[model samples]
Target: MSVDSDPDMFSSQTTVASNWSKDERSQKDTFNWAMEMMSHGQYLPLKSQASLNLEDLQYSTKMYYIRQARLACEIVCESIAPSQGIELLTQVYQSMKLKTAETKKKDAVTDTIISAYKKAEDYTTKVQILSLIVEKYSKSELLSFIEGLTIYKIDAARKYASTHGPGQYVTPPKITRLRLSKQKIHHFIEFISAPCYLQVVGFGSRHLKLSSGLTVKVPKVIRTMIASRLITAYNNYCKDNTILPPCRATQYKIIKACAASQLKSLHGLDNYISDGMESIDTLKKVVSNLGTKGLQTSKVSDLIQSLDTLKLHLKNEFRSHLSTESDCSQHCMHFALSEKGCEHTHSNICQPCDRMYQIRDEIQNVMTSNFSNIEIQEKEELEHDILVSTEKNLGLEGSFY
Candidate 1:
């Protein structure tokens, strides 16, 4: 009886194994057919059909499918940029995984494929692609996916090592103080270093506005001036070796104060003054250092003298030009006035009475010059004649008197 039961049990076990084998073969066949269709651009017919269980498909089938997709990508790439190929590779990688196992869990797998592709090139375009992925995908999923792809493809594997693999550049390397946290630091660098116009208010009570596309290397003199104001800011805010973080409205005030203080400290208070606005004075006081107080009086005096000289020269040139214009206009007006047909009337004048004033001024100046010289000559002759008469009277004594 025991021997008979054993044969029966063996038959049952064999039947179960046979059924499992059949299922496996069927999945493998389905995967093979899917891959062949993909190669021939014949996937349209199979897109919606759930004809096979991917989890049941043989591992060999999945590998061949991936290889075919990669080859197809390469063929397309030969005629275009590798980026186009990589994008296609990424899509195909996702589609294959979609057909295979857990759809939701494939994100990690797909991300890994993308990272592997990026590692293939250190090109700027590749780096840009990686940056986009980093922003779009979760960090852990991205790291894990790259790990898996690298296992079979050693170059990808090596590149993965460069980041997560051993002997890679340090994960979070030492950077400048400003770049302490990668994300925050990068943002700060972009913000502070961006080319934008600065609208400043408070230096010498003026709302000073200036646009700067200046780089890190500010001129020594300008740097010194700014440093002086920074020193004031440091003293006022009680910090050193750092500038105040910009905060919208407050930024303009702080910058203006700092700039004013620096200019006054390094050059002179008067040098930074603007007549245009009233806030600059308040800023100047805010940034002013008690210890480094007064502006250099002598320099201010010198600048004043230089300005005065320039003003005088400009005034003389202006007056001379006006005089020349007036004379020309006067001659033209006189000619017009003297004409018998001048009865056409001033109503026809284009530029108004300003031209009449100019003409009158020119005529007066000309008349004054000519009349003054003649009158002087006549007066001298009268004096000479009086002297001659006195001399004659003296010579003739009482008779002549």
Candidate 2:
């Protein structure tokens, strides 16, 4: 299937090489140009007269050779078994030096088979890749994929396989779309790219179910809507208005890439998810989990406001008396020996360092300590332990006396 091994496909005639003195690049150009001119598979002829004339003069090959090669590529490729195409390409390329008149004709024919083999390889690979990526595509996606390849790829279809080439054309010539205005396109773009599309936007997003039975929980502060929802909306709007909208590729590109600044990420809900909110949710679940799942906390919604308490405590209670230039060294020099300041080197926190020990202790209590039993039971247990110790000491005192 590979074309690189074939010798006759790009053979240089001795007379032409010696007299005309064309380089290897010129040889390749002439060979490809000749093959293209004779090809039936939607090859575009040189349009400009100057370009055409330049090619004819530059190539300067026999018409008979071009004809034989073209016929071998288009007519002969189909006439033989597909396996024969590869075989002929290999056989003629290896055996023929193409110095004599007969060998030159063999060389030209072999050149044709090379093109045929290349087409075969290209077709096989195209099918293999398309098999994997062909998903549930809306009409918009198909248009974007084949945007610029208008007549070229279509013309390159298999003519021999079917009775009619790619079936009959359905549309009338004049009714097809020509140029779409950017004026109309901007409407769709602006609709999807805006912060909030409907009246319910801003302040907070309320969770709502679409008519299609999909649930959308948008971000309270930022946009958390899915891209597919917007794409579906665009399609419906375009259909209702009888107007052409941009393809899904264009719509997706605008949001994911083109308008990435306006719309931050793909998963709309991830943008505003803070650790504080998550902690509050976890605590609320724990409170509800108590009482054998009967739920004691009636005001679970107010748990969200606990973040404000942490902030207030940090702002009001943490009184670090040290100035900007006064680092740990100056603060701890009175209580420590090392110039590195009071490393305080305590188990929990540094004393007189941040003055936030109470806040730290409270945070640790909420996060790690269990508050299941009431404080009354703990106080009773401590009192019992002290009384027992006192009794034991009194017995020892009596023995000493």
On lDDT, the candidate that comes out on top is 2
Please list the C-alpha lDDT of all candidates, in the order they appear. Answer: 0.39, 0.41
In terms of TM-score, the best-performing candidate is 2
- Candidate 1 local lDDT, 1-401, one digit each (tens): 57576898879888999999777765546655655554465332222323467676678776655565556456554335544766765676788865654443556645674755656665433433444344334444555555443222443434544555332333456774332345533443333222111223233242334457543422222222233333233333323225444333343444443332222331232221122112222222222221133334553344334334433322122112221112333223333234443322232232322332332233234334433554566435534433443333223221101
Estimate the TM-score for candidate 1: 0.15
Per-candidate alpha-carbon RMSD to the true structure: 29.2, 29.2
Q: For model 2, where is the 10-residue window of minimal lDDT? A: 314-323
lDDT of 2 by residue, 53-157 (tens): 434654444454455555556434434545476566655565553333233222354345333434544553432222222222222332344433233333333
Clashing pairs in 2: none
